[model samples]
Target: MSGGVDSSVTAALLAEQDFDLSAVFMRNWDTKDELGADGKCEWEKDWHDVQQVCKLLDIPCRMVDLSREYWLRVFEPALRVWERGMTPNPDVDCNREIKFDALVQRLGESAQWIATGHYAHLQWDDATHRAMLCRSVDRHKDQSYFLAAVQEPQLRRFMFPISHMTKPQLRELAHARGLPTASREDSVGICFVGQKRRFEQFISEYIPPSPGKIVDEHGKVIGEHNGLWKFTIGESSRVSGLKTRFYVAKKDAERNEIVAVPGRDHPMLQCRAVNTIDWRWVWPDHDVQQVLALQTKLGGRFTTKIRHAMAEIECTPSQGTSPENVVLSFAHPDAGVAPGQTAALYLNEWCLGCGTITETTCTADLQESASSEPT
Candidate 1:
């Protein structure tokens, strides 16, 4: 439930139905080691809220500690990606690894179906005999992108109670029903990071300082960086002593250096193609064959989103260097496409699946002739 308004309302809505209802709050983070900014355990507070909501709903509730599962499955893997100077979407991993895989296993045969407050829909596909992940009616609040890595089996047993309604509508219902969390603000950003600390500050505690050089596009050292993990591609390189603003164009992990370019719309920031490793499809067999056949017969016909909230871009998918790898060729150069980020695939409103980007082909070559020009 996460002790949020959406989940509270979800429980309330379900209580009116005849189905057997039991609320289980999965504690993915352990706050015993570290407290919040207010010097109180964050998860404890959330668990309290969950208890209150469940009490009002009159459902049997329990707390399932999945911190160990989350640490081994999501956090550790994400830390490795961060150490390599690549962006990692931990939320996507949490949905697939913790929520769907570990939590479902914990329930075992006790629960027939799992429901959540995620703003995504599940549609049963008659042709494929599988469940398809679809976008919520609230387009702005759609979260299908995060669930792209979830396989068909998990999708079949999942349900979203608030998928058909908008955020405002849901909140209104919560208010009418007197949900305690009716006015509670929605949670944002990564869960463990919390709202108090900067991402760089939070990550620094786990990763030791590995200082590196920050170089310009011309290969001239401009400044020093505390760590490559602190910087992300396409974000303004807040390096001191620069007359004009610069943005991070690339992270050369092998050299332990960052490539910064002048201007926000620099050619070096535009990525023409993204190559993903360990590509996962919701309907693994059928979807793989479908994309391959489409590529062979008619180039490609798929839209992809490298990150959430951004509009999907038309892309042509083809087999990458290996069978497990997939290359998504963007129709237009995409800026800020970073390695380690999940590239979610979709056919219109239906989310097909996603892959973790391993490399990005940029448009830096087009600007080689103009590189010598003074900034």
Candidate 2:
């Protein structure tokens, strides 16, 4: 249950329906002595809350330590991506690898279905005869982006109890039920790791900083960075010595440099296409080959999102340089498409699939924008 309002309410609502319910609080992170802002091991506090909720709801609650699985499956792969100077969306992998894959195996022969507090919807598609991922009724809080990599098999055996309610409404429901977590603040930061330590700080434990130069697009040095792993594509906070506000345009990993630009709409930050790997579709009937063919032949259109909480943008799918890779071509240049981020595809409200961005096609017509580049 994660000891959060959403999961607490999920258990409450399920209990209300009189379905046989048992709760499990998965302890995926095992960082000893790593405390959160509240000066306690985040998982320990969360386990206490889970126990309280289970007692209040009169249900069985169990704790499963999946620290090893999480590290091997989610953390290591993500760190490898970071080592490559690319930003990986570990949350997506967590959902796919840990939450669904490992958890399901752990629950073998015990439960027929699993439910979570994720803010996404699932509905049966009659045409496709499959359960499709849909946008939550609370559009602003939809989390289909994070859940995009979850396969159809895993998804079919899942339910999201609070998909129809907004965050405030969820809090109200919990409050009315006298749930202890009603007033608890929402958890933020990395999926498993707490926000008590900065992301760079947490990463530094493993990846020691290799200080490098920060340069503009033309190879002119502007500043210095502690490490390339500490910066993301389009990041501006870590950069300095620029006269006007500058956004991270790109990271030259080969040169061990962070490229900065004065304006937010710098050409390097904008791309006409993004190539992706590790593609997965939630719908069994859909495939990348068909999507590419449709886009290339019939000029089919779909909606896409590079990161969470952003409005979906219309895009066209096409074959990338390799068979395993698919490229998304946007009508206009898109900003902040970092390699290793997900390219979540959608059709209307249904989440189609997601792919890991590997490369991007910079805006070709940057002559005018480059002319005004910061000197």
Candidate 3:
């Protein structure tokens, strides 16, 4: 339990049931370990809330220090990606590596099943004899995308207590039950970074400044950047001397340059396809093969989302440059598509799996023309 209202309500619901109930709060980050850091994560307050909830629920509770595991398994790998000037989702990694994998190992044979407040559903598939991950009833609060990287074995042992309810309904239930966290605001953004610290400032402590050039579409240097990590694809560049606004079109890691274009809707910002690395599928091998076969016979059959809360967009999956990779061809051009972002796949409401984007095919014709022009 993250000491949040959702988890607190989850504990309350389970306590009313006949099963053996226990609450475990995971400490994934240690603020003291962050050398020369300004703001700290309110993990202590969260742990206090968790303790209070467990006391009210009358369940055995314990704190599991998984900070070392998280730093090695999730944060280090993410830092590598960031240093390469690509975006990485640490939350997704935390769900797969720390919560499901490491935490389950810690529990060993003591616990039969693991339950959480994740807004996703799990169903048994008799045909495949495996557990299938599904979307929650609350489409707006659905979090299946973050669990896409989790293996099927992990999904089998997982349960989502709040899968059937919406956010407001869950809060109402918590309030009626007199839960202490009923009115507590939901946590947002990255946990380690907290609510106050700027992302650039937090990341700068780890990644040394590698100043680079910000260039326009025609390869003209427009402004200077402190580091590639400071900018994100498709966001306004905020280049001061420019008469008009500029949006980040691309990040050239090899050149150490950020390419910015004149308007928000610039053609350069739109990507028609993306290639993924380290592709993983939650379905069985046979099931995945069948889907690929169907895709070959038909057109795009799967819908995909590159980030949470984004509407699912139709896409066609095919073999990428390598065996481990999968390339998704979007039905329509999508702006702000960037490398290192996970592309979660779904067949209607069932989340199939996801992959980290390694490359994007932005309006190819326009890119060729732009490159052909004189600098």
TM-score of each: 0.93, 0.91, 0.94
Residue 208 error, candidate 3, Å: 1.3
Over 317-354, each residue of candidate 1 has an lDDT whose tens digit, in order, gives 77877766888888898888899999988766778788
Cα error, candidate 3, residue 352 (Å): 0.7
lDDT of 2 by residue, 73-148 (tens): 9999999889889989888899999899999999997998899999999999676668889899888878999999
Quote the positional error of residue 168 for candidate 2 in Å.
1.7
Decreasing TM-score order of the candidates: 3, 1, 2
Candidate 3, residues 1-375, lDDT tens digits: the string is 999998998898888998888889999997766564466458888999999988888899999999999999999999999999999999999998999999999999898988999999998877667888989999999999999999787888888999999999999999999898999998888878877788888898899999899999899999999888889998999799788999998899999999999987788888888889888888646244667775666554689999896878898877766656888899998888889999988876778888999888888555797799998
Question: Candidate 1 local accuracy as lDDT?
Answer: 0.87
Against the reference, the lDDT scores of all candidates come to 0.87, 0.84, 0.87
Clashes within 3 Å, all models in order: 0, 0, 0
